[model samples]
Target: MDESSVRKMSPRRAAELLSKTPGEELSLQAWEGLREVCVSGMQDERLSADERIGWAAAGALVVDRMRDHSECADRRVAMASEARLRAYVITRFGREDDSSLRDLSLLIRRVVDAVGAESWVVADSADGWQRMTRHEMLELRRIKNLVTPFKSILPLLSPTDPLRDKIKEWVDIIPLLP
Candidate 1:
């Protein structure tokens, strides 16, 4: 599909297309379309919260797939995708709520693992454990703070949750103090 065709699609329809399309044939156009749909869905006031969350989650998954396939070849695109995922979490769940904290921690850790510090340094010249963008620093702090509350309840979280593994990696890379 072309950019124009994808842009005209509704969020639900875009997500449908994304889900239906074979992974090998998934084009940049389709990805952009889904991203646009998510962006527009978040901005639309008429959509229900559940609908918006669905779109946002779909968008994040698309980015995650992109990262896995592309191997962070395009640093700018990777960074933008991660940022959009974070924005979706913030927009959907708010910044400081329990849900937001948990979800945002997951999102941040996903970026750290998927994109890696090398990609981030290449993309923004953010040295590992030294100079980071304010946003990156904030995300690290948020992940730490959020994970603290879940340590005792960790068994309740799904075993498949990446947080169980990625939190240790985040701690090793992200400086404890900004």
Candidate 2:
């Protein structure tokens, strides 16, 4: 499909198309189309809650695909996708009473691991560290607020569940945030 058509497509239809596309490997065009559909869906305020969730799921799927196919040579794009997915989750669900928090935590961990210290560096200057610290502080506040209610139940997760570790790690690190 052309860019214009993809731009005008409904989130449901875009998700349907993405679902049909083989996951073994995605062509550049296919990936771009899916990305556009997801961004459009997220930005379009007329969509119902269900539609927005579907679009967010689509964005999550893209993040998962990027993680699985790490050699896709689009690290920056994947980072942006993950950031958008995280923001969508935070905006849609302010608490961690559901599985969406698990997804968001995992995405944040993945981005942190993939980008390393670079993710914390927003610019190249002595003052950049201050800006980065402010951003980290805000993220820490959001994460703490979202995960505190679920803290008691997090340990009950199976040892094999990666989110258990990720959440614990975040909880442990939040205390040291400046």
RMSD values for the candidates in order, in angstroms, are: 9.3, 9.1
* C-alpha TM-scores of all predictions: 0.49, 0.50
Native-referenced Cα lDDT, model 2 = 0.54
lDDT of 1 by residue, 1-178 (tens): 5446655666567667766655446665566565666666655668776666666755765665555454345544544565555644564455442544226565555555544454234323324535677787655444344323323333433668655554444334334434
Model 2 compared with the native: what TM-score? 0.50
Q: Report the C-alpha lDDT of model 2 over 1-178, residue by residue, as the tens digit.
A: 4456656666667666656655546765566566666766765678886677677766666555664563556454566556556655555544353556235555555555544433124222223234566656554444334334334434555789665675565445434433
Q: Model 1: clashing residue pairs?
A: none
Error of 1 at 105 (Å): 1.8
Question: How many backbone clashes are present in model 1?
Answer: 0
